[model samples]
Target chain A: MAERVVEARHLSKVYQMGDVEVHALRGLSLDINRGEAMAIMGPSGSGKSTLMNILGCLDRPSAGSYHLDGESVANLDDDQLADIRNRKVGFVFQTFNLLRRTSALENVELPLRYAGVGAGRRQRAIAALEAVGLGERLDHRPNELSGGQQQRVAIARALVNEPAIIMADEPTGNLDSKAGADIMKLLLKLNRQDGKTLIIVTHDSDVAEQTDRIVLIRDGQVEADRKLGRSKKIASKGK
Target chain B: MDFIASLQAAIESITANKLRSALTVLGIVIGVGAVIAMLAIGRGAQDSIAGSIEGIGTNLLFVMRGDSQNQVRNPQPLTMDDAAALSDVFQAPSVINVAPLLQGSATVSARGESTTTTLNGITSEHEAVRGWSVSEGEFINSSHLLGRSAVVLLGTAVADDLFGRHDGLVGETVRINGQPFRVIGILAERGTGGFSNENDTVMVPLTTAQARLLQRSTPRSVDVILVQAVDADAVPQASEQVANILRTRHRTALGADDFTIINQQDFLDTAASITGVLTIFLGGIAAISLLVGGIGIMNIMLVSVIERTREIGLRKALGARKRDILFQFLAESSLLSLIGGILGITLGWLISVGVGAIAAAANADIVPKIGIDSVLLATLFSMAVGLFFGLYPANQAANLQPVEALRYE
Candidate 1:
């Protein structure tokens, strides 16, 4: 029922190596609605990662029409793409690509720095870290923290800028089962309570079952789109 | 990031690689130190020469008879009457004092000890012209001339050689050219004057030497006519007047002139110009070492860029601008050279002080004067070397693409 936040038409990504041309994404079109928690499920080489990159504005589609919040991203330059990534989209990686030598607070403050936020905006960063249950570990660096804490710091960094959408690539792939479940719970809480659009790419069936809807991607095309009945149980527990 | 942060990062990185940084900086240190030390020694030598020339008095002039060709052909000496005629006839306000010198070499014996020395016949005013002072007893004066006393003033070297640790040679008789002459004074040591030893000569009144020692008619044949100008500012005028008067007395026109007037001021100026040129030549050669040091910096920076490729890529991925990366490397290189320059300056100063001490111990007239300009120049040159050599690698780092850099392992 919510308005569509992302619209893609005839999107294709190609790579050229020597004389060989490989198409990573093939003529894909999709729409992502606002306030929706969706999981894009696919096996290896299914082009899910490519789709996620294109959606996050990290890489451009070779030939396609991508409208992110009603703005065409297909014709944008690298800087413009980076600007869109900085201003609109937030990314969380499976490995938690946080700066190794810097503290958690500084990691969350990175996007704010790109946004030209002054030092006075530190309170916003503290709030974001506290939102991810990482307020107590703000001064700890990535190497000093546990796996779950590091992922929480990454999530805090992703949500610090209050972006339009959070695109995660196997956000819990590197964590243990318990940590993975905890991260899933946090993602679900962010989706339902904060009303943020969340698109996660994962191969785990249990993780996919937690989202509001699941879109099965096979060979760079959507195979099935289903809304979950289990969301009702999670929604009851959210209150 | 802010400048302070960037500088702090650069310093931290440099400090982390302590041995590598120290070795790199050592090249610059030696280069700068050599440049400073060489220039200081050269400058000190120049100053010493100029100081010695000044001690001899710039207002003095020497008039010698005949040109080089005639001196080779006839070896005819000048007459004392010629000196008097010029002194009386010139009548210029710039003319202050004139003395004629007749020099000859002979063996002088005293108390069974003998030394070969140069004997010089001169007037009382010769002391003023030659800037000589008596170390002990009286100099030959009007009384000695009026009495035609056979008296001589022994130079320090002559007295030391002939007397052999004896004190107060005054009133003692020393035989000059086989004739006895009482020692009236001992002249202070005047050091060497390039061509010969100045302290090996003995002085006596011209009339007394001619009458008693030389046994020659006219008794006026002289080697040089010494003249002192009334003031330093009047030397040029006095020199020209003496030349003109001598030429008139000799009845010679320009180009056919028989006498040569040597101006001490002109000689000092010429010596200064020559030493300046020598200093630049030596300094230029020494600057080559600095250039080599700069090349060493370039070599090291290139290697550093290659070694830190991953770090550069990571920083670029973190949103560092091209200028940021460039400034980081440039700052590192500059710090290397700056530290080296400081150490080099200190080393050069210590070396100069050590050299000065050695010279002082040996009682040599050489004094090394280290200048402030050399230190400042070395510092600036080292910085310039850093900037110049660091440019290529910095450019390579700055131009790296963020995507390619992030993908770099």
Candidate 2:
């Protein structure tokens, strides 16, 4: 009975490389409801990243109908897609992707800046950083932060806009086991406490086990979809 | 993103690499500085030349023998009669006064010293016509002209050269080419203004020069005539009126007048045009350096675009539009060039002042003139160069696809 956050039907993508036609995606349909913490598992070249990119509004599906929050995203221009990305979705990357030489506070405030939210930007940015237990590291640049701290800052930036969906691509890939566990726990806390719709693409089975649903991707199509029981505290700190 | 935020990011990026930014701005600085200095020097030269020309007296015209197509040998030169006719206000209404002159070099001896000096034959009104003043004694009066007196006025230079210690030159005898002539006056020293040296000549009456000094078969032929207008604004009208009178009197048709009239203002205009051309030429050369500087900006901006590929990708992924990236880079480039322009203007002003000081020390006539207009123009031009040259790189940054750029590692 929950409102569907993403309604994608029959998406296909073909990339031409000189004389060879490379079919990265066949036809794939997907639907994710509100407050669903989903994990997409795939091997390399399986077109999992491509679907993630499309759903995040970073790219348009080659042949498909995509409705994000009931708005048709297939025909939207770049600016409109950017607006959707800014206001409706947030992204976290394995690399943390924070602007170098910029403070953590500024990094967290970037979305608000793009949304034209000027007043109280500093206070809100501080509060967001504080929410992520990074209050003292607001002035620290990305290079100065630890791997876990950097990922925490990225998560703080993602949560700043209160986006309808949080999309992360290998969010813990660059971290060690312990830092990866911390990041996964933080993501779980966002899903539980903030009620965010979390969608993450990862190859780690242990990381996948913590999600409420697991969607397996192969050859640009969804191979299997399964609903998991409640989180079994896959991240040790979450227990 | 908002403009202020983008600008802040740009400023931070620029400040992060101080040496690179400074090196990048050097081209714009030198380009703009060279332009300012060239303009200042050009304007300064023009003003000084005009100042010296105006020193020769305003609204004054010189009528000299040009070419005579009808007469081949010793074509009738401007005579004292012609000067007298022009002096008649009824005949040439714009012509205020005229002085007929005859000049020749002669050995002037006083006491035991002798020096070769220019001998000018002029009447008393020559003082008023030439804006000259006497320092010691009276100038050549009407009586001296009528009596054909054997007397001379010693210019300060020739007077000093011949009679260094001798005083009372007013009544002293100074021989002109072995002919004894009484020294009547010593002219004031008015440093070289190119209307001949004011303090380096000897003057006698026009009648006496024809009678005893430069004796010729012709009775009243003078070498040149100096005509003064009533006022500054009346000069062009006065020149035309004088030309008309001379044309009618000589029976020469239009464009066939045997005499050439040169107003002081003509010298001013000619000098101005020469300096103006020089300014443009120098500014153009400097602008080439500016052009090169703009290219330098483009080159570095392209490099920056390449280096920030990942940053561009991340911003796009984080919801930055293409125009946002374009505006950010463009704003950074413009800020770079504008800062360079400000520094360059300051440096150019300093260079001009320093050069002016050196010129003053060396006794040069002109001082470098830096105008506010040049500064404002330089600033605007630098920013325009920044914007113009920055377009390609900014476009390159904006056109990157987020997926491709993110994979640029």
Candidate 3:
């Protein structure tokens, strides 16, 4: 009886590349619950990236309905979708896409700037950075920080908006094994202690095994949904 | 985002690429500079022409006997009697004074120095009517005219040529047509006027010149009559009155009068119109460069939009609306023109000063006029150019799809 944070009935996306039609997604259906740490895995051309894009509100499905945090958003306009992305879905790209030559704190404050949060933005951004163990690196630019530290700053940016879900696309794809493990631990902690819903898109099984659930996408549809070790909240409720 | 924030962001981006920003605004700077300098020079030329005309005399009429346009064959000469008739206040109410000039070129010599110069036969009233004054000694008087004395007032140029000095020439004797005449005064230098050089002539009593200097066709005949009006506003009335009296005296019908009354205002109006055309022509040419500068802005903005495609995408991904993107680009371009405009003003002023300096070095009496109106116009026009040229690139940036732009390499 857990509350669902994401509910996708069916989705399809077709992209026209010149004269040919390319089907990136078709009949995709998936659900993720609140406070869940889930990983979506698929091979190349399996449409996992397309699903992530749809779920993050960066793109709309050509045919299908999607509900993120109980709001039907598949039919929303680009501006409305942008608002949804700003308010409900935070994104962490694989490239650590922090703005060049910008201080870490300013990069984190960007979403709040767009959200039109005026006076308290600085304080909130600082708190988010401090939560990610980057309080001392507030003024350090992305180039000045280590790979692990850069990813932590990205996490802080994602967390600053307090979105319903943080979508991290291959969060550790560009990080070393040690930095990757640290980021994985941090993301898991946010889900476990702070009850934040987390959806990570990665092909690494080792990374998938750490999540509470793994949904494998094949040819734009969910091919498998598997639950691994017991989640802390469920175990605590059982006790 | 708010305007201030967008402006701040635009400034940040512009400053980040300082070299490109500077180069982009250089076109605008040159354009505005050209506009300001051209306008200043044009206005200066107009002012100098008007100044030279006014420098001669205002509210005065030059009356000559022949109507040159009519090609009058054997035209009757203007006479001293006609001058007396026009001087009668009952006949010409606007007339203030009348002076007759009987001039002839002669060989004048002083202390073994001789220069061929014009001898002007003028009564004492001629000084006030011509606005000419003596720097050292007195002008001809009634006694000099009645006595027909052999005394003369030296013009500055004549004095300088004959005596190597303009002042202290009084009591020195000079010869007109080989007849010795005492120098009574030195007339102050009057620079060249619209028609001729007033500084290169010698003045003598009318009776003396009529009796001693040259052979005349008639005893009462004069070369030209100078008429003065009460004020500048009385010129038209004074002119009509003088014409009527002359026509009646000459026994000629309307339009067949053998005389021309040249109003000083006519010369002023003609110069004003000519210089007006010159100012507009110069300004129009400069405005073309400004238009080119606007195109340069547009060209650079388009390049910037292409170069910063990913940045635009990133801003959009962060929840920037279309208007926000549009305004950001527009702000950057406008800021460029604003900076260029200020710098261009300084450059333009320097150019005008340089031009004035060159003119002064060449002994030309021209001063470049830089008015606040032109500066304001250049500033506002440059800014408008920036905004106008910025529209297309800004629109292009705003319409960029986030997904496509983010993917742009």
| Winner by lDDT | 3
Query: Deviation in angstroms for B184 in model 3?
Result: 1.9
Query: Higher TM-score: candidate 2 or 3?
Result: 3
Clashing residue pairs, candidate 1? B78-B222
**Alpha-carbon error at A149 in model 3, in Å?**
2.6
lDDT of 1 at A132: 94
Highest TM-score scorer? 3
Off by over 4 Å in 1: A1-118, A121-239, B65-76, B89-91, B102-122, B142-150, B154-169, B172-181, B188-202, B206-219, B362-372
CA lDDT of every candidate: 0.79, 0.87, 0.88
Better of 1 and 3 by TM-score: 3
Candidate 3: where is the Cα deviation over 4 Å?
A: A232-239, B65-75, B102-121, B143-150, B175-181, B189-201, B205-224
Q: How well does model 1 score by local distance difference test?
A: 0.79
DockQ of each candidate, alpha-carbon based:
0.19, 0.72, 0.54
Candidate 2, TM-score of its B chain? 0.86
**DockQ head-to-head 2 vs 3, winner:** 2
Residue A139's lDDT within candidate 3 is: 96
Which candidate achieves the best DockQ against the true structure?
Answer: 2
Tell me the lDDT of model 3 at B104.
95
In model 2, how large is the Cα lDDT of residue B283? 88
